[model samples]
Target chain A: MLSKKAQYAFRALAHLVEHYDSGPVLIAEIAKKKRIPLKFLESILLELKKNNILESKKGKGGGYFLKKDPSQTYIATVIRIVDGPISLLPCVSLYFYQRCKNCNEKHCGLHDIMKSVRDATLNILEKRTLKDLI
Target chain B: MLSKKAQYAFRALAHLVEHYDSGPVLIAEIAKKKRIPLKFLESILLELKKNNILESKKGKGGGYFLKKDPSQTYIATVIRIVDGPISLLPCVSLYFYQRCKNCNEKHCGLHDIMKSVRDATLNILEKRTLKDLI
Candidate 1:
C-alpha cells in the first residue's frame, strides 16, 4: 500500500497539475483543497523540490509549481521518489534490488512470482503520467 | 513493499508447502531452513492457523502443516490474511475497501489507475497458489 506521505504527495501534485499553466500555488491552498495538513505538505513539497519534480518561489505571491510538464511526469517516478521500491520483495525490485536473506534468487519461487507482480504493477505506473491523473 | 512479517510468513509457508505430505514438520527445521527467527515463525504459523490456512500438532513428530492442499491455497488469500490489502490504494481495494480522504472516488484519477493496477496484480496473485510457489 502507498504510504500516507506518498498519497498526500500525489494529491498535492494533482492539485498542482490542475494549476500547471496558472503559475505557482500556495502550500496553504493545496492543503485546504486536498485536506492534507499544511505542515505535512510543506515537507512533502520540499522533498519534491529537492528531487527536481517541483520548483518554488519566495516572498510576495510566492508558492510552488511543477518543475516539469504533467505529461512528462510519470506516476512510477513519483512513487519511487516518495515511497521507495514498488516491488513487494527486495529481491524482485528492479530499481531497488537487494538480495533476500536465505534464498537463492535463481531457485526461489517467491522471487519468480513477485518479479511478475512487479512487472505488472510497473506496466501501469510507468505508463500513466500526471497528465493522465487529471 | 511487503512488511517483514508478511515476507517471513510467506517464507515459512513456502517451507510448509514443500513438506506438505510428509507429516508435520518441526518449527526449528523451518526456522533454520528459511532463516526466519524461531519466535517470529511461531507467531506467523499461529496466525496462519487462525486463518485456517495452517494447523499444528503437538508431542513427538509434531509440528505445523498446511490445513488445505497447496494447490487450493492462493497467494492472494495468504497476503490478505497476513498483510491486509493488496491494492496500492484503499479505495481501489476489493477485499479491504475504504473511502480515501478528501477525494471523490468517482472522479479520482489515482483511484481509477490504482484500480487497474489492482486488477493486474490480482490476475497474477489469485491464479498463483502455494503449489506454484513450490
Candidate 2:
C-alpha cells in the first residue's frame, strides 16, 4: 500500500502541476487546496524541494514550484521520495535490496514471485509520468 | 508495503508447502524453521486455517497441513486473507473498494495509475500458486 505521506505528496504535486505556469504557490495555499495538513505538508514540500522535484521562493508572494515540467517528473520518483522501496519484499527490491534471512534468493519460491510482482509494479510506475497523473 | 502479518503468513505457508505431503507440521516447527516468533506463528496459522488455506490436527503426531493442494492455492488469496485489499488505493480495489476522500474517481489521475498498479499486482499474484512459490 502507498503510505499516507506518498499519497499527500502526489496530491500536493498534482496541485502544483495545475498551477505550474502561475509562478510560486504558497505552502498554505497548497495545504488548503490539497486538503493536506499544513505542518505535514510543510515537511513533505520541503523534502520534495530538497530532492529537486520542487523549488521555492521567499518573501511576499513567495511559495513553491516544480523544478521540472510535470511531464518530466514521474509518480514513481515521488513515491520513492516519500515511501522507500516499491517492492513488497526487501529481497526483491531493485533500488533497496536486502537479503532475506535464512532464504536463498535463487531457489526461493516467494522471492521468485515477489520479483515478478516488483517488476510488474515498476513497469507501470516508471512509464507513467506526473503529466499522465495530472 | 506488505504487512508483517502478511509476510509471516507467506513464510509459514511456504514452510507448509515444502512439507505438504509429510503429514501435519507443528506450529512450533514452522516458527523455528522460518525464524518467526512462536506466538505470532500461532495466530498466523490459526488465521490461515480459518480461511481454509490450512487445516490443523491437535494431539499426538498432529500439527498443520494445507487444506487444498499447494498447486491450487494462490499467493493473492493468502495476502487478501491477511492484509485485506491488494490495491494501493482503496477506490481501485476490487474486493475492498472504498471512495477516496475529496476525490472523484472518474477524473483523478492517481486513481488511473493506481488501478493499473492494482491490476499488475493482481495479475502476478492471482496466477502464481503456492506451488509456484514452493
TM-score of chain A, all candidates = 0.96, 0.96
Q: Residue A115 in model 2: shift from native, Å?
A: 0.7
Q: Write the per-residue lDDT of candidate 1 for residues A8-87, one digit (tens) a residue.
A: 99999999999998988999999998899999999999999999899999988989999998989899999999999999
Candidate 2, residues B22-50: lDDT per residue as tens digits? 99999999999889999988998999899
User: Which CAPRI category fits model 1?
Assistant: high
Report backbone clashes per prediction.
Answer: 0, 1
Q: Report lDDT (Cα) of residue B41, candidate 1.
A: 84
Residue B71, candidate 2: C-alpha displacement in angstroms: 1.4
**Interface RMSD values, listed in order for every candidate:** 0.9, 1.2
Q: Please give the TM-score that candidate 2 achieves against the real structure.
A: 0.96
In angstroms, give how far residue B70 of model 2 lies from its true place: 0.7
In candidate 2, how many Å is residue A55 off? Answer: 0.3
RMSD of 2: 1.2
> Considering only N, C-alpha and C atoms within 3 Å, which residue pairs clash in candidate 2?
A1-B1
* Tens-digit per-residue lDDT, A70-134, candidate 2: 88987788888889888988898888888888678889888898898888998999988888766
Model 2, residue A43: C-alpha shift (Å): 1.1
Candidate 1's interface RMSD, please? Answer: 0.9
